[model samples]
Target: MADPTTATPASGKPGHRRRRVRDLRAMPGFTTTAWITIVTLYLPILVLVAFSFNENRSVVLWTGFSLDWYAKALENDGIRNAAWVSVKVALFATVISTIVATMAALATTRTKKFAGQGLVFGIINQPLMIPEIVTAIATLSLFALVKKITGLSGIGYLMLAHAAFCIPFAYMPIRARLETMTLTLEQAAADLYAPPLKVFTLVTLPLLGPGIVAGAMLAFVVSLDDVIITLMIAGPGETTLPIYILGAIRRGITPEINAVSTILVAVSVLLVILLFVVQRRMQR
Candidate 1:
């Protein structure tokens, strides 16, 4: 009898070896780092949301938990006025930015080739790449020039500046969506003798709906939160929420500011949840 350990297949047969696959994704260090990063970044946001309900006026201390801050925030006239202004700016800026960005995206993506496309994209995105202070100064200077030349002043200039600032934020996602989307469906519609307006309304616009909505949301949020540019470009009685909050802080840290912050935080949270639910439903 042959020894068990020494047993072998027939001489002409080849030896078989199994290849073990390694999952790069399952690496322990990588997962640990990712979890750490997520926690580090989100912990402050979670704390902010949690403490917004704190009864204490102090941001650092949690004396007790109550909903009084929300009530006070609702009743505060200054906060309400600032919030209203911010809402108007965000709404107008979002609409104008969406329209402009959509046109820019369509122009860049649909045209086979266009002169100065790169230059145009660079100019549109300059605000994002440059420092806020630089943009604020430039906007202020331009506002001065416009006022000197036109001898006109109103909220319209503020709206235009906010829209311009928001254009890059709106353009990025819309342009990306356009690039990834196929043109065959649009071409097919045109071949079927569909009018240009009808083709855009029925085919292109429908497919681009989500991107447009997302871009609008982003532009609105940016406009709502902007401080420096708004401070520079805003006219009389055009104080936004962030600027109000800053002024409140400079004067003193009052329960009013805390109250206002809490309310804003709550609204932001609700918006996020609503967006998530809408996205999930759309996917389904």
Candidate 2:
């Protein structure tokens, strides 16, 4: 044997080291940027949640423990009315958006070479990709023109504006579900002598139930939290919770706003949990 070790290539050791480095690079690890972003975004929310229970009026000092702010927020007629209006608007917008989005999802996913299908989907999803401020301003301008001609004055303007913004939020999840769902069950239902209505009622609707519920919840949350579009369209008496919160904060940030914010956050968390349960049941 003429020295077996001499047959190994000189580049082998460095090549191994380079491969190890490449593998390390390919596997993602938390970086400085991610940490910075987490701190920047969540720190304020942490502070708000923490100080909501503070006894002092000023947020800077936590004088003692108290639930007085929550009580006061509940008692404020202005806040109560604004919250009720927001709930109403959000519910209406959620219903309308969910219906339109579900139909759009069905049409886009089920059909082939339909005229205007592309146009319809594009228009329905445009709000999501476009700047929200642009949509708000355009909606306000159009509504202003309509009001001048028709003399219309009601919460209808706010409802329409919220629905417009909520459509894309509702469409995306339902479309995703439709695209991923297997059609074999529907086909089998047809083969079994089931009518189209029966198949849809017994098979398709139940399968799509989780998706519809999730999408509606998303739309409702978006509508509830919307401030820019609501502020642009809502009339004086039709002040939604977001607009009221903005007005309150402009005066000064108070524990009441914190209490309200906590409640909103709690609602969103509960809905998300409910969605998870529904989705799990559907999968089973």
Clash totals, every prediction = 0, 0
Per-candidate Cα RMSD to the true structure, in Å, reads: 6.8, 5.5
Number of residue pairs clashing in candidate 1, backbone atoms closer than 3 angstroms, sequence gap of 3 or more or interchain: 0
Estimate, for each residue in 1-284, the C-alpha lDDT of model 1 and write its tens digit.
33322244442322231111134226668988999999999897777766767888787888898888778878878888889999998899999999999999999998887788789989989989999989898988999998999999988888888999999988987887788789999999999999999999999999887778778877887888898998877877889898888888899866667667666666666766765665454455
| Per-residue lDDT value at 76 in model 2 | 94
Tens-digit lDDT string for candidate 2 (148-185): 99998899989988887898989887887888789999
Maximum-TM-score candidate: 2
lDDT of each: 0.81, 0.87
Location of the lowest summed lDDT over 10 successive residues in candidate 1: 13-22
Error of 2 at 128 (Å): 1.4
Q: List the residue pairs that clash in candidate 2.
A: none
